[model samples]
Target: MRIERLRATPVAVPYVHDEIWAFGRRRGQVSVLLEVETDEGVTGLGEAAAYPSADIVLAVLRSVEPLVLGEDPFAIERLMRRIELIGTWHHVKATSPAIAAVEMACWDIVGKVCGQPLVNLLGGRFRERVECFFYVARSDPAEVAREARRASESGFSTCYLKVGSDEPNTDIERVEALRDGAGPSARLRIDANEAWAPGTAVRMIRELARFDLELVEQPVSGRNLDELGYVRSRVEVPLLANEASWTRHEQLAVLKAGAADVLSVDNQMDGGLLNLKRSAGMCEAAGLPVVKHSLGELGVALAAAVHAIAATPNFTYANQAYGALLSDDITEGFGGGVAGYTDGHVDVPAEPGLGVTLDPDRVARYAELYRTEGAAFSFGDPDPVLRSPALPKF
Candidate 1:
C-alpha cells in the first residue's frame, strides 16, 4: 500500500516526577507523534524526541510532507535518503528526529502488511524479553538512594543515576548513598551528561570508583574525544559514550580513540531503528556491547525500542526506555500501556507493527496541552542549577 497521509501531532505529557539533569529540569515532556496512514487502511505510529524544542521537530516533519506523501511506505531507505539529501541541501540540523519518526512509522507499516512483528522483520528475536534499567533523576542523596532501593525492591537489577553536579563531593555522596541503598549487588550506572571538564571528570570518576559503578556515561563533553579517552584511561570503570557518538562515523571515531568501553545507542539520536541496528553491528564487530538510550520516550518510542532490542544480539547492558517515568502515555494494551516494563524487563510484543495500539482519547488530551500550554521548559532557558559551585579551599 502506498502512503496516503502523514499526521504529526505534538503532545505535552507530564512526567511522573521532575526530571532533573545537569542542563535543566523538566516537569513535563513534549514529543511529536507521527501517524502514517496507508491507502489500505493500515496506520502506523511513531514518536519523535522533542525535548529542548518540539516546534522545530514539528516544523521539520511538516517540511518533509511533500517528500513522503504518496510514496511507498516499504521504500524506507529511499525515503530516508531523499530526506537526508534535502536536509543536507537546506542545512537543516533538526531533521534526524523527524526523519526517525517517519522511518519508524514506515517500519510499523511494513510489519503490519507482512503480518509479522517488527523484531521478526528487523531480523528475528534475539531474546524473549529486553532488560531495562530504572532511571533515577538527580535529587537529594537520601531521595535518590530511596528511589534506588525502590527500584531494587521492585525487581530491577540495574538503576541509572543522573550525576555531574557542580559540587564534586555532592556527586560522590549521591553515588555512595545509592550504593548503600542498593545493597552492593545492584548495578548502578551514572550519566554525567557532559557536565564535567576533562580534569574534573578524571578526578571525579577516580573518587567515585570506591562505590563500584557499573559504568560512567559521557563524563566529559561529547565533542572532546581526547578528553573522554583520557578520562577513560584514568578510571577503572567502563566509560560509556552517550552524547559523544550518534552516527556510525562518530561511533567509529570513538572506538578508534579507545574512548569508551560501551556504546550507548539511542534510536532517536541515531535517526531510526535501522540506523541504530547498523551502529550496533559496528559496535559488535569492534567487540563492544551496545546499550539502548532513551530521551524521555513514551509508549510508541518505547515499543519501537523493545523491538530493536529484541533484534539486536550484542545489547548486553540494561536498556533505558524511560516509559515508566512518564505519568501517562498515548498508547495502550501492553504491560504498562504498551511501554511498561515488568520486573525490569519488557517482553517483545509478538503481534504485528510495533504490537501496540494508540489511545486516541489520551492522544487528543496531550495534543491539546501541546497546542495551548507548550513545553514546560526549553533547553535555551537558563540552565537549572542543582547545586552551586563550591568554595575554594586554601
Candidate 2:
C-alpha cells in the first residue's frame, strides 16, 4: 500500500514520580506519536521519544515527508535507505527517533496489510512474554527501600535504580536500602549514565558491588573505549554499554575495543526495529548478550519494542520500560503502568500489527497536557543551581 501522509503528535504524560538521573530530572515523558495513513485505508502507528527535543522530532517528520509520501510502506528497507542516504539523515544519530518512527509506522502497515502481528513478521515468537525491571526513580533511602520492597513483593525479579549522583556515598546508601527492601533475592541493577571517570568508576563500582549489583551500566564515559575497558577490567560487576552503543556502528566499535560485557540497544537510538534485531544478532555473534534501553517511552513505543524483543532470542535481561514511572498511558488496556503488567512481565500483543490500539480520548488529554505544562516535562534539568550539569563527578 502506498503511504498517504504522516501525522505527528507531541504529547506529554505525567510520571508517577519525577525520574532523577545523574545530570537531569523529568517529571514525565514526551513522545512524538506518528500515524502513517495509507491509500488503502490502512494506518500504521509509531512512537518516538522526544530524544533531543520534541521540536527536533517534529521538524524531522516535516523534512522527511517528501521522502516518505507515495512510497510503498511495505518496502521498509528501501524506504529507510532512501531516508538515510538520499535524505542525508544517516549520520545524524540524534535524528534517529523521527526516522525510526517512520520505519516503525511502515512495519505496522506491513503487518496490518499481511494480517500478521509484528512479532511474526520480525520472527515468530521466541518468547510469548517479556520480562521488565521495576524502575525505582532516585529518592531518599526510605523511599528507595519502599520502591524496592514493592517490586520484590510484586514478584519483579529485577529492580533498576539510578546511581552516579554527585555524592558517591549517597548512591551506596540507596543501593543498601534497595537491598534491604527488595531482599537478597532480587536482582539489583544500577545505571550511572556515563557520569564517572575511569578511576572513579572503578572505585565506586567496587564499593557498590558489595551490595550484589547484577550489572553496572555506562559507569565511565562512552566516547573513550579505552576508559570503558579500564573500568571493565577493574570491576567485578559486568558492564552494560548504553551511550557507548547507541548505533550499530558504535556497537561494532565497542565490540572491537572489548569495552563491555553486555550491550544495551534501542530502536529509537539506532533507526528501527530491524536495526534492533540486527544489533542483537551482532552482539550474539560476538558472544555477548543485549538488553533493551529506553529513553522513557510510553505505551505505543513500549508495545513496539516488546514485539521485536519477543521475536528475538538474546534479550536475556529484564528490558527497560517506563511502566513503573508513567501514571497513565494512551493505549487500550496494554502497557499502562503496574496495572498493565503481571509479575513484571508484559505479554506480547497477539493482535495484528502492534496488537495495541491508541485511545483517542487519552491522546487528546495528553496532547493538551503537552500544550499547557510541557516545559516541565522536557529532558532539560530545571534545577537552576545545577546549571549545565557536567559528568565525571568526582
How does each model score on TM-score?
0.93, 0.98
lDDT of 2 by residue, 312-361 (tens): 89999999998889899988998778878889999998888987799999
Strongest candidate by TM-score: 2
Pairs that clash in candidate 2 = none
**Candidate 2: Cα lDDT at 316:** 97
What TM-score would candidate 1 get against the native? Answer: 0.93
- TM-score of predicted model 2? 0.98
lDDT of 2: 0.90
- Write one digit per residue (lDDT tens) for candidate 1, span 76-192: 988888777865522432235777899999999999989999999988998989998887875799988888887887778888888876567888888988898788799999988
Q: Considering summed lDDT, which 10 consecutive residues are worst modelled in model 1? A: 385-394
Positional deviation of 341 in candidate 2, in angstroms?
0.9
- Candidate 2: deviation at residue 79, Å? 0.3
